[model samples]
Target: MTGRNSGATRRTPAENAQLALLLEVAGTPKPGNVDRRRDLEDLRFEHFLAGTVGAGKGLRRAEHGARVGIAFERAVAGMSRQSGGNTQFGCLLLLVPLVSAAARGDLTPDGLDRVVADTTVEDAVSFYRAFEHVDVAVRDPPAEMDDLDVRRGEAAAPTLRERGLTLSDVLALSTGDAAGGGMEEEARGETDGEPGAETEAGTRGIPDWNAVDWTTGFERPFAVAASIRDDTGPIGDRTARAFLEVLADRPDTLVATSHGPAVARDVSERAADVRGDLEAADALADALVEEGINPGTTADTVAAGLFVALERGLSV
Candidate 1:
């Protein structure tokens, strides 16, 4: 543990040395040097505590909710990066401290609430921007030129290489379901006697009654939901709401399908499954990248999928 700084007016010599040490450790190239990362995290944790106390005084003088919320959100993001390893598991560790601090009124709960409410399409982009170095991107699997019916499981999995994303390009994919519209309601006849206008008692019902298209309406959001689920597992209700709110500016609008209700239910369930798959992939990538694995073709596929999903929806 580093020495504590008790003096209000000046930094101790030990504190100055610790700050320098943190910077140097973060710049190292060794793979999974968690000890070095941990040092930097510890410093940030100290800053989080200090900021919580300091922000309370500032909040009293602030009036704009938006401004306050942005500051609060940034503070929380910083606190999250600190406190330990920056993996998803490490993030959970900070939740308890965050809740306790917020409960004491040291950190403004309203500020966080406002931030959560403000998850607009713009916010989604902003979220990516804030964490650019973390390698978060949209996921979209590509269409197999050789095999059109290929699923992700059959495709070779790839992990991140360098500091950039190359596979599962979410931006280029279409999100509509694979099925065409259901139902065959007749057009109102101009001629009353045109082709059996008056049907017998045993008339044929809708031919495609059971034909539900996977590539139809609600695809984009569902795909987005799927990717998020894959990457992070099924988030809580509040988290899901926050995510949807952030994507409010997405251009795709869904028309209710024949099985719209059923689709909605399935989409939610599928999102969770996707999330689990994604987290496992991320963890695998982290380990492989640490071990100097050559992603090669796998990297390209992941990047392609990510681009396709984000831009075109899940149709790819």
Candidate 2:
């Protein structure tokens, strides 16, 4: 189940991660998100295919101690040029480190954490560069830090530099609690001395991006991976179920960003009701698309989960 090698006559871990991304997008009736049968005006199935393949290859070839931010920037830049649009930005953020960890012959929680802790300030710079290359929509930052707005893109680089924030620092700042407050409150012990401190106690003693559920430890991905691993059925069914479970468990941050907290909460509740009911889930998926409510962050997490599942040799 290790990610180091796929054995003779098998695809590499990078290839498996790519396949997982493609299959996740291809899974039909996946609620509000895009699938093989559904496509957004600016985002299409082909765009995802190109992005996944390009980013997966870039991640596969990345060297140890390489700045994940730089790797992410290169992957997204290539994808943007090829697809002429933004697709899989979040997927790349989650997968690049996993790819790097697998390359190092370890995909365990501890292994991945070590990789994340090693990211540098240059990595944070590269992250902001990637943001500039895309047209991602996110919620506004705190009122006090207008310069930190992601919408500002590379324009925020100087501020990031002045503050000496690393990639993990940026992620920690963006990480939000269920109540949508800053991470400061919930990140007490997990982070360093300051609430929501960038670093953790162990490992490299550097910033702890794993402080948030979405960033490190691959928490959500691991949960969904375990679900997919336990399933013994068609890959499509397993993927759909895993997506439902994730959607039901948490309100999608992307949804909250685009719409609002209310819409995100409603979608989560709907997912909970439809979970475990294939027919109901299908109907709900159609209704969500009609309503223009996409649980995109959930879909991104699902892609990462599929990657983990594949890396671990889950049958499918």
Candidate 3:
């Protein structure tokens, strides 16, 4: 029951989603992320491409009305087929629901909101299953919920079922925004914070801000999509710029996790300084690469954003 959005492009929603993955990696000068010319010690550009190719199966499943959790897990499984490991885990987290919403004939924020909210405990179980296939760089879960640690993978399933937590519930709990406005703070992520400290880690394990995107009405990616749509010049350049915008808006949780929050905030400040200066941006790109500071979460959001922009008719 897959459906396409009525628009100028003839490609299926699945094709557009895959193209977004390609476009995000192809964009040059994306500081701290694997791109046309950059590769982390563990991840290469080709790995991303291969991951994209494998991701199609999962994307198609989502388009055809697969449960959000099931589609995301399958997509993660397919994406893990490559040597790059978990190249697009966060991207798929955002894209699976977006593609499902589009196929269901409502691609707006409200529509996406409902899709995640409607997830079942089975979906949570499937999401945990995704972790078993790939080595995503996730922190350990909170202590009280050690039984639900994603690292426990399939072993966490029975606990999830007993708790009656849906995939959305799991994500919201992971972000610790279920009971506060921290979810909203993560949605914008550009506000002031300590330059030498990690942002107050509301919760430890699971993915961070992108998981927040799951619970925050998917605001950040859509906003980044708007930035992409309003920009000019080559699509690669547009993507590069949008990547920076996301970095500027928030200290990337991935960078924060591996490098510490202070470094992540410093990176965000650097991104803000890039503003209209591509030369400065390129310089920062070089520095980030040299320092091994990978703002992968920002890249994932940008990929999801690119998908949103393309689906809404941003052209090639």
Prediction 3 global C-alpha lDDT: 0.77
Top candidate by lDDT: 3
lDDT of 3 by residue, 63-174 (tens): 9998988998899889889775678887888889988987887777788888987899999889888878876555544466678777677898889888898888888876
What is residue 98's positional error in candidate 2, in angstroms? 0.9
- Against the true structure, candidate 1 reaches a TM-score of 0.20
- Writing each residue's lDDT as its tens digit, candidate 1 over 1-316 gives 1122234533322222222222222221211122222222123234323323333322222212333223323433442343331221111111222222232333223422332333343322322232322211111122332221112211212211221221111111122211111111111001111112322111122111111111122223234334533543222221222222222212101101211222223333333333324343334324423432211111111221222222222111
Q: List the residue pairs that clash in candidate 2.
A: 198-207, 198-208, 199-207, 199-208
- Which one wins on TM-score? 3
Per-model lDDT? 0.24, 0.67, 0.77
Model 2 misplacement above 4 A = 1-5, 63-65, 82-84, 177-211, 214-216
Candidate with the larger TM-score of 1 and 3: 3
Clashing pairs in 3: 189-249, 190-249, 198-261
In candidate 3 the C-alpha lDDT for residue 183 amounts to 18
